[model samples]
Target: MPPPARRPVGTVTRGTTNPNRLRRVDRWIGYALGGLLRSAAGSPVVVDLGYGASPVTVLELADRLRGVREDVRVVGVEIDPERVERGRPLADPPWVDFARGGFEVPLPAGLGADARPLVVRAFNVLRQYDEVEVWPAWQRVVDRLAPGGSLVEGTCDELGRLAAWVDVRRGEDGLATPRTLTISLRLAGLETPSVVAERLPKALIHRNVPGERVHTVLGALDRAWERAAPLASFGARQRFVATARSLREDGWPVVDGPARWRLGELSLDWAAVAPS
Candidate 1:
């Protein structure tokens, strides 16, 4: 007789999902990890953990990544068996697949010796857990990463207009450390950059209060946005560029330059907004 199946780690989410809802993060990954994918040997796997209710995002990720690495494989993982089945019809063999798993990030059986994923995008997954549960969850996912791989985890609003995520990598000591915090916004009608406080990753969401580094950063962002208002006549994108420049000028350690800033996105060293 076959052995009993082991249960997947982590809880099922609310299953909320939508098409194009993950475009912001997908675009960021294609830009941020492009070189990593290009330099990897053979095919590199990417896991869309907790892809909740649909595989649209998985399909989208594969489509975007193929532009960077033609052989990139994408696996959509969920703890819910029904969601897995729901996505199977769209699976395209080795290039794109659906699996039933959680933070353990189980890969397909017999997927060669280098079966670990190079990038694990776990968006909107941990918001349902207690804040204390986050680090353990991150560690579980990070443990499954290939050398030099990354675990991108965060939360976003329903419409995907506002989003924030942490790029976590394994340190030399084998511990997972968040290396950067990034905020992406739809600047067309954006009122204040601090509005992202509502969509911050679990690690920093609650930390967006006085005495916390995250709070301090968001406050500075709001001030910068207001100061850049005069540039709005040039367009929202230009105004956002100015906001990003202002942040950098104020010694905020902004990561990217005008090219990325025009996309209404900004990334800062994790130390800048890590919880106090």
Candidate 2:
């Protein structure tokens, strides 16, 4: 006999999705965290939570990660059963699948009980929830992660031009911790790196006000970006690289280097910009 299905944790989101809207984070998943997938025991499972009205982004995620690990499997998880049905026809099995779920992160039954996700990218999922709900939601997702797995949660603009996310991983104490805050921009038309403040994850969004650590960080990024304007004549990418360097030089604890900065992205220890 079939077992009764357990209810999925979390709630229905706006489900607003667009093609390529998640490219920046997907690049990060493929490039920066690709090693995790490669070292995983078996074919790694990645969860695209709250993949909204469409499954397009989850499909895109699968295609991108396949370049890193050919056996990578992606599950588009949505609390909306209708959206789940909408995505099933698009599923290619083993490579891509759609399931009705929320932060609980359900996988296909065939994957077996040991198949926890190596990465859970929950972009824009928590935006609709109160800031107070962020940590709890993160905990729920982290609890479902495979060892050494990570949960990337945050928000991005509709066009995918500006974005910010927190990479949450389990700590030594077996609790979730937001280890780093990453901001990715479309350098071609970028004005200032601080523009990401508007797209920060739910946890830090309201903390952008004065006196908060995140606010200070954004202010510093803006100043550094302004100081890099002369380099803009070379290219936005170059200018952004300079901006990233300046942040590190000024003791902002920037992570990565010019190689990543060239991608219009910057990352900092979560401690550096965590709410006061």
Name the runs in model 2 displaced over 4 angstroms: 1-3
Candidate 2's displacement at residue 144, Å, is: 0.7
How displaced is residue 11 in candidate 2, in Å?
1.4
lDDT by residue for model 1 (163-228), tens: 999999999999999999999999998999999999999998888889999999999999999999
- Candidate 2, 1-276: lDDT as tens digits: 889988888888888889999999999988779889999888999999999999899899999999999999899999999999999999988789988888888899878877899999999989999989988889989999999999999899999999999999998988889999999998888877788888999999999999999999999999999999999889998899999999999999998899989999899999998988
Best by lDDT: 1
Looking at model 2, the pairs that clash are 15-52
